[model samples]
Target: MVTRQRLRRRNIGILALLLAGLVCFGVVEGVALPRQDQMEAQYNAAQNSPLTHDIARTSHYATRYMGNASKVTGLFRSLPLGPIRSFALDPDVFTVQVNLDASAPMAEIDRDRAYLYSATAAFAYIDNLEAVIFNEGSVAYRVTREGLLTWYGLDGFAALTADSAVWKTEVQDKLAEQDYARRAFQELFRESKTLSV
Candidate 1:
């Protein structure tokens, strides 16, 4: 049988440990983490985001790269078919029509594929194009385009970290704003956790 005095001491020791733990957790989560998250957020707000800028710049460069593809691999006998067939961006919807000459040359199709793959890497390049021989006895291709900004924003979010309520709110706001961008990413991501072209 344990004495009352020893039982009291044991309770006091456990209480003391619990109090210390609470204090340490409070300091780390409430005090230290908030300040750090705020400082980082401030720094990010002031300077251009490396991720966004890089992605934007990449989008720009990729567009240019695709534009000049025909010169390197040779022009398709006709227009290039977009990969996207249809895109529904909530209030907005984009429908594409692609009618490229398939008989132009096999090499031309290969080059176009390279352009599509590269742009798709940076943006939402669709590939629903189908090779069809029209009633006129001619071959044609169709392509489509989709939201690209969403991918850019998601790629950016991967670099940010936070542990404060304020910073967490800020992150939420930024993500919300990204939804309104030309290419709605949140919806797309919600539909597919891991996006792929």
Candidate 2:
């Protein structure tokens, strides 16, 4: 019973409404979803990355050593090889050097001394893993009597060899922790997205 013009108008109205809905959906998705996905991807990449973890840990230890003069010596002594562990994993990527002043304060001297011990222990640790310590200084310094004396004096080597099993266990534990953190972050991210919606 409708006139032709009326039917045409109704069809045009329906088409316009559909077009508006499509534009609204597109605008919301284009503005929001891509940005959210990008952010999540970046967060996941950083959180799950071993290099990132290593850099963070190295920075943390370095900051701790630099900030706390009272505890620096004891902490360094406790983790003699910790300074070089991150670098040891990729010799080709890193060039490490230790410059120590014999006339410095006891704390400074202890820190440098600890670093030297770490360098030595790192050499041994990498060598044990069948990787060559290509740094000439690393190779040459360890051959001298002073180096030998330092090696014999510290319990670093003994600890490294004796606690090899513990090191593996610790790595596994760290992986588990990372996994847990990643899951928690993912849950939080999902919650944030839901809240935003």
Winner by lDDT = 2
Q: What is the lDDT of residue 16 in candidate 2?
A: 100
Steric overlap count per candidate: 6, 0
For model 1, the local distance difference test gives 0.32
TM-score of 2: 0.24
Clashing pairs in 1: 82-143, 82-144, 83-126, 83-127, 83-144, 84-144
lDDT of 1 by residue, 2-72 (tens): 78889999999999999999999999999999999998887555323211211222222222222243321
User: Where does model 1 exceed 4 Å of error?
Assistant: 49-197
- Taking all chains together, each candidate's TM-score versus the true structure is 0.26, 0.24
- List per-prediction Cα lDDT, in the order shown: 0.32, 0.35
The C-alpha RMSD of each candidate to the native structure, in angstroms, is: 18.4, 19.0
Question: Any runs in candidate 2 off by more than 4 Å, and if so which?
Answer: 49-197
